[model samples]
Target: MKTIAILFIAFCSTISFGQTEKESDIVINNSQQDDTYRAGETIHVNAAIQGDLVTAGGKLIINDSIYEDFTAAGGELFLNDYIADDVRVAAGRITVDAEIGDDLVVFAGEVILTENAVVHGNLKCFAGNIEIHGDVMGNLDIKGADILIDGTVKETSKIVGEDITIGSNAKFHKEVQYWSSEGQMDFKDSLVNTEAYFDEDLGEEKSELSLISLGIASFSLWIFYVLSAFLVILVLHALFKNAFSNAVEGLQNNLLKSFGYGLIYLLGIPLLIVLALVVIIGIPIGLFITTIFIFSLLFGHLIAALLLVYYYKQKKEKDWGFWNITFLALGIAIILRLLTIIPFLGILLSVIILSITYGALTLNVIHSKKQFVKT
Candidate 1:
């Protein structure tokens, strides 16, 4: 019986990933043409994507062609295909190939541009270490701990790092602007115009100014979001407390499944809308349905998050404290919002995780209500 229960849960987990028309859980490979995705225990992409590709998992590999842009936020992202447009990626490790028509912006722990890779535009990166051996038609703007460039940059280059290396084969057309941690500047290679900035007075002054500006902006945004969220939660605290608590619980219990759901919806809705155009009446319906799905998914995630917090309280055998839940819930909400900015897959995965958490919590509530009626 225990094994059966475990197997049943596992089966639900598997089915949850491949669902197309389901609500509250992850939906994978939902529609037809131009977009293809499979969200299961993990996400595997082995097909062509005419549009953008978004996925979330421990590892994501795109060994196929992407006609449009590709954005991913996850642990490890490997793209060994042809992407016609820009590639914006945020991950732990990012490897890119194929041809990109526009600029490539990446934020990761480690970034690599292999030999066969080609980019028609600029390559900007923020990572711990970046190694480029590919061909970039424009400048390479890199900010990281260590940067190694063995590729071709058709335009100027600006690099800021603790350690910077411009390999022998690496060619930069215009000038080189570098910022380093070492007090002294090293101009090892022959260059037309090479300018180096030290981390002392000049860099320090600029850094202070930039930091102040960033801090102000960040604080303002935070305050606004916090206030808005507080007002909403306060108004509906009684009604939404349970729902919110359940959503958080779901996230804690099944974060990956929630992510899988996001992977499905983020990539599927557009494809469905395109299919809906086959019949004129389907256009409005499709749009409306997509909007509802997106909203519901977001709401569900919020509810799940709340539930997770409440579950923790129950486990500890402590009284439910509204202030504690409120504070933590708001914090999580803010963090999730920040996660959404991560390229294509990040936003979608966040949505999926939240939706599953929220939906499951809602179901529990409805069931409990029904049970009360029987009593």
Candidate 2:
């Protein structure tokens, strides 16, 4: 717990590193830096980095090489250089025309690996459109709407998509597993020196579900959560329509206050529960506190779903219509659940999200009480 707290604090402190407008629009050319961490509207790096590079902005373009890990988030990212370590990025549009010495983790709307790109380690991507014209030395795990592979893979490749096209020039030294539509497997005979498995009836099944359950399990957890959240929202929207709208309005109206309350709830609850457990006479109380804490944790996703539903629906109009909150919640859940793939800076990310959800819920409850008192 102490370690988790320290890590969370450290992560929080790093959030504002070079976040100023002037400092963010950096274009480093013919320079060397030990480590780089910046947040801006636009970031451009053309110099070598000896250590890790962490940045976030509206637009990020890296034209120099890095000796260590590279992490970034932005509206769009373009990597035109090499990295000696792993690369993790979240962006709207991602274009990699360089080399990754290690693994690659990406969540984006569009991912394009130019012919010059290469990954020496594993590759994982969640995107709407993926076009790979490079080489992957390790396994490739990808989920997208459309995937076009004209690359070479030394290891296995797994893909989940609506439409998957393996260019005639694409080569895989090992097996390939994919899930696609019913009639998309029209190039079976053209595949050479490779075994392919299609999850649906697009082609013959190379391997059964039992063989790939682990891989599926790892990625499908988010999908399941999303479906479940959507279902719950449908019911909640129908029954507690006003409450959902109130929650959303409360959050939007009092972002800072809600976040503050959320922070308190997260840290204070655990301490209170532990203190209650210190006395024999308070055992039942401790148990009750523990239960409530656990319940809060369990309901975290629901709160998120509600928040999302409320925001999405309210944005359609100022007065806000309560009828379609369920569908709006589904849209929000889709986006939140998709972000579950990122795991590098673990607890801090979780804490940030939890705070927002808890805060929104608490703020709504407080406001609801004021209205009750007025009545």
lDDT of 2 by residue, 1-375 (tens): 122222322322222231212233667776666887665556788788888987765678998889999987666689999999999876667899999999999867789999999999999987778999999999998877778998888898787776788898788788877788644465544356777776563223323322231213445654544544543344334334455556667777787887788899899988988888898888888876666566455445555766665676577664544435556557755555445335754346556667877777677667656766799
Model 1 CA deviation exceeding 4 Å by range: 1-32, 35-41, 183-332, 335-375
Q: lDDT for each of the candidates?
A: 0.59, 0.68
Candidate No. with top lDDT: 2
Name the runs in model 2 displaced over 4 angstroms. 1-24, 188-190, 200-375
Candidate 1 vs. true structure, TM-score: 0.51
Model 1 agreement with the true structure over 1-375: per-residue lDDT tens digits: 122222322322322332222222233333225644322223556666777765544456777677777765555678887887888766567788767878898866788899988889898886778899999898878877777888777787777777777787777667767777764666556353554444444345335433321113467656644544443233223234444444445545556665555455556766887788668989887765555554444343344345556667766777756656756666665666566657897666665555555445444445456656789
Q: Give the TM-score of candidate 2.
A: 0.51
Query: How many Å off is the CA of 225 in candidate 1?
Result: 12
